[model samples]
Each structure stands twice: as structure tokens, then as C-alpha cells.
Target chain A: MADHKTKASAKTSSPSGGEEAYVPPALANLIGYYLRIAQEASFQAIRQGTGKSDLKPGWYTLLTILSENPGVTPTELSKLCGRDRSTLTSTLNGLDARGLIARRRKAGDQRSYGVKLTAAGEAMLRKLQVIARAHDERLDAIVGKDKPLLMTLLRRIVDELGNGYPPPPARGLGKTSRTR
Target chain B: MADHKTKASAKTSSPSGGEEAYVPPALANLIGYYLRIAQEASFQAIRQGTGKSDLKPGWYTLLTILSENPGVTPTELSKLCGRDRSTLTSTLNGLDARGLIARRRKAGDQRSYGVKLTAAGEAMLRKLQVIARAHDERLDAIVGKDKPLLMTLLRRIVDELGNGYPPPPARGLGKTSRTR
Candidate 1:
């Protein structure tokens, strides 16, 4: 079993000479097993990095996308974040009130609005980007040389999983999404 | 950019002569981005599979752990699932009410209880296990033969990230946890 092997290897190879290795269930062999836990770590790391900030849990994703595609529609942005429009509105409104993002009707398409990062929004994004970079660096330090390997696997899972499964109703990010 | 390349590749390589390929943002390069979306997919799959089940989100992990380790302690289960005692209590009580898990004082240690799966619990777990396997197969079909590769990569991330970052309150699973 994977748990048995990991425990045995840890017992023989550990420098601490103690019970450092944990015996995980057989389900640990599944990708779902690790996703649940690793996602928790990722969520916590983001919280630690963005603590007490005005941005909500999913805000950074919104800002990052808006920065990349300046005239993106709210509906398209909602699709990108895999969030429903209603859940996204309050966060978008918060950013708008803070003057971090601006919404305007497109010249030709009055039905849809273009969302963009303002000068202040861009400035805030720069700060958030720094925090994200540092957080990512910490993950890289742990994942080490396999960091790229892990990224490829995750990205592949996202693409492949997306191919098969319809996105769930984005109800506050399943378990991780929350307002600060 | 990752999205640009994806958009370009999709534009050029589309056999359907249409736009099925999605251009993910720069954040898609990060593990958190994929985790959030993948977790959404996993949640929907499970919800669809277990729509009327009384068991909540964290119940599967609890049942899975109990079935594996018949006399495991709550503290140990908490450690394995990365949940706190406070959060585990509510879930444990629900399982207890359902007569799925039994908590009894250890023969020697009068203070601590050793939790085990009841007969009904084991039966329910077997049924849930069926749902879990089919669900995993759906994911496997998506991830393809590379399922093992993705699983290994995820396991490494969990171990490596866990060493650096403490568990994130174990707030219902961040992604998905399933039976073996």
C-alpha cells in the first residue's frame, strides 16, 4: 500500500528518529484525495497573504483577468471565474465603490458593459501581485524542482476535468470562497 | 501569455471550425486557479451522485477513515482529515445519530473513545463506495490514462505543501475526498 510504503520509508530514512510519517488511507492514492487537502493549503496561503485586505476570496482572480482583458464583459468574466453573475456582482460592486474597477457601456454594445481596472485598481493589483508571487514562491520551495511538474498536472486536470464535467453552480467556491 | 497561446492554438487547430478551446487567464498558470475550478466540477459530480443522501460533505472522509481503521480515535481522524475537533464534533454527532459510527471508551483508556463503524455504517459506506468509484471513473475518463500521473503529482503537492502550511480549518473539503 502507498501508506505502508511511505510509513516504512519515513521510518528508515527520517533523520528525526520519530513518527514523522503519517499513515494515509488507501483513498489517498486518488487525485481527489490530494485535491481536497492541497486546495485547503492553497486557500489558507491566499488568506494569509491577503489578510485584512478589501479584496474578497475571488476578487484577485477578477482583477487579474480584467487587467489582462481590459474590456471584458461581466458575463464573460463570470464565466472565466466559474462564478454566477449574482455572487460576482457584490464583489464587483465592492471593487467599483473602492474605485479599483470601472464599468462602462461599450460604444456599439449598449446591452453589455466593459469592465476595466482603473489606475488605482492597477496600483492595487501590483501590490496583490507581489503578495501572490511571494505565496507562489513558498509553494515552489516546498514542491521544489517538481514545481513545474505539479503545475502541469494541475493545469492538465483543469483542462481534462473541464472537458468532461460541467462547472458546478459557483456557490462561494464550493468550500474555500468567503468574504473577509 | 498562457491564455494567448491557448487561444491561438485553439483558433488554428479547431477541427469543428468553432471555439471550444478556452483561453484561461495568467492565474490559470497557478495551482490555486485550477484547484478552485476543478473542485467546482468535483462538487457538482458528487452532488449529482448523492442528491438525497443525509450525509454532508465531510461525511465521506469520516466514513472512509472509520472503515479503514476500525478503532481510530477522533483526534487521529481529525489529523488525517486535517479538521479541528470543534468542526468534527458536528459531523460526528450526525453520524452518531444515523447509527453509522459508534463511540466507546477504550478498554484501557477510560477517558478517550475509540470510534468504529457500525454494521449499518459499514453497509452505508459500501453503498457510498459504489457512488465514489463511479464518480472517480468519470474523473479518470477525463484525466485519461494520465490519471496516475496526476494523482502522484497531487499527492506530492499535499505532502510538500502540508509540511509548509498548516491545514486550512478543514472547512468541508476544498475539493473532494472519496472512499477507497
Candidate 2:
């Protein structure tokens, strides 16, 4: 389906030439848009640095999760990453085929599988980290001295948007109970 | 091809218990993931509030652009919206079918068309503004006072990425000009 969607739109030279268009001023202030652009920049940087390695950002993510939490089940990882089981299944299969990771059935749950990184996976992740760091540093450099301010703002937004912490207490409310 | 892909996936799911899977942490913090989630949230909010109206976020963006820049060209709007000409072509068809906007051939350029919102489009945009405001407020509510911070961070990221901006300044030893 994705392939068809891509192919169907592949013939178009430009994606935005049309009449009666709608533009949102708020888009300029959108965090989501910023994140998207940054990620794309990071991806491009990594791809260039690595000479177009087959490993995608998704593959790196899977490798990281397995490295951090050995014996983690696919279900647990899916919830953490907010992907559907089917998508994870395919990703796992691909990674396994590449011999970067291995999946074995859990002892008690016959239906469930435990995922872990292979030695090659660790080596790749370590190498990729350099690229990721360089990407992040470049992102920081682009913002200049304002990098800290920007990160602070993003963290605040993340907290506010339920991406991380809960909202602060309402105005004039008594001391809020701690809920981490 | 899309149908075939869907069918194949469906067949696999029928036999499985549809168990949930995990996503790796490496991909979790990528900008694309956050952008996708944010877009999904905004889309869902729009759908929930204006499902019967058949309005879409893309259409709302078009109306806003036209409202801001009256008599904007289709090609210009397409560039601003970051969508391909083909998709914009179909989108314009739908908007025109609803009588929400009108397009006229440019006086000088045979290939270009100037776009404007109709009275109906203006009215619809006005109504959508209320719903959009509510959604924005909800988004704001989520972030609370952190919105300013989030906006700052987002702007920094955007600036660094050069996603909506022109190419980065040439690397040299000189004080950089600041433009917001």
C-alpha cells in the first residue's frame, strides 16, 4: 500500500501547485513541523556520513531498545515506541534477516518473543551513535547560543502536551501532589 | 498493488491473535515520530469537530493562505504548503466542487492561475477558525505556559534545519546576521 501510494504520487514534479489552497499561519509556530524538519536534516546528515547505509532510523531505534533492555518482549517495545504489532513484526523480521538482532520465544509465553541485539548490532549502534551525535551537534550549532533556550522550550512543550509530564497546577491552587 | 498489500497483511493478521508489539527507543526521539504524532493529534481533532462538514486541515491551510495573501497563485500556494502539484491539483478540484474558492487564469502567464476564496470559503474558514482555536487552546492547555518555550525551541530547530528557510550561510569567520 505504501509502495502504491508512493508510486501514484511519484510522477508529480511538485507537490504544492494548486488553486484555492489553504495555508495555516499557526504552522510557523508548530512544534511538530519543527521536529519533522530537524529529523529530516538529521537523517540526511547520517545518510551522507554513512555513505547510505541500509540501516534506517527505525533499525537504529530497534537496536537501541534491545541493547538497553535485553530480553524485552516485542509487545513491550511496541508500546514504548507507539507502533502497531504488525509494523514491529515486519521490522523485527527485517532486522533478524540482516543478522543485527535475534528473537527467541519467551519460556512461559509461547506466543511472545524476546528480542536482543547481536554483536554486529552493537557495533553498528556504536558507530551510528557518532553520526547521531554529529547530527545533534549540527542541529545545536544551527541554533547557536539559543540551543539551550530552544531545548528548554521543547521540554516545556513536551511536558505540557502530555508527551512527558502532567500539566502544572491551576492558578492559586494549593501545593500540587507529586506525580512523576 | 495497494489492495494486494492490504490483503496480504490481512491474511497474516487473521491467523495471529493480533498481539501488540514494541517499537525501539532509538526511533522514539526522532523528530519525525513527534511530528507524525502531532499531525495525527491535530487531524483527529479536526475530524472529530468537523467530520460532517467534510473540511480537512489541508483545506483550512489553503483558506488561511488565501485570506492572508489575496490573489495568490496556485504555484505559489503549492510551494508554501510543501505539497506536490498533482496532490494540490486534486485538492483544488475538491475545494472547487464545494464552491469554497475560485481560480482565474493569470493575465500575463498562461500556465499560472490565481486563487481566491469565495464568500462560502470565507464563511467556512470563519467557522473553522472557532474549531481551530479550540484545538489550539487545547494544545496550549496541554503545554500551558510552556507554549512560548516550545515555540522558541521549535523555531530554533526549524532555523537550524533550514527546512522552511533558504540555504545556510557560508562557513566563514565573521559575525552572523540575525533574522527572524
Write the residue-wise lDDT of candidate 2 on B88-153 in tens digits.
778888888999889989999898888889999899888877777776766666666767766666
lDDT of 1 by residue, A24-132 (tens): 5657665665676667656765776676777555567778888998988887786565554566778888899999999999999888899999999998888877877
Q: Which stretches of candidate 1 lie over 4 Å from their true place?
A: A1-23, A55-57, A105-113, A138-152, A163-180, B1-23, B55-57, B105-112, B141-149, B165-180
- For every prediction, compared with the true complex, DockQ reads 0.18, 0.13
Cα shift from native, residue A115, model 1 (Å): 2.8
Segments in model 2 whose C-alpha atoms lie over 4 Å from true places = A1-52, A144-149, A163-180, B1-53, B107-109, B141-150, B163-180
**Candidate 2 local lDDT, A20-43, one digit each (tens):** 223256555654444444454445
Return the top candidate by TM-score. Answer: 1
CAPRI verdict (incorrect, acceptable, medium, high) for model 1: incorrect
Question: lDDT of each prediction vs. the true structure?
Answer: 0.63, 0.57
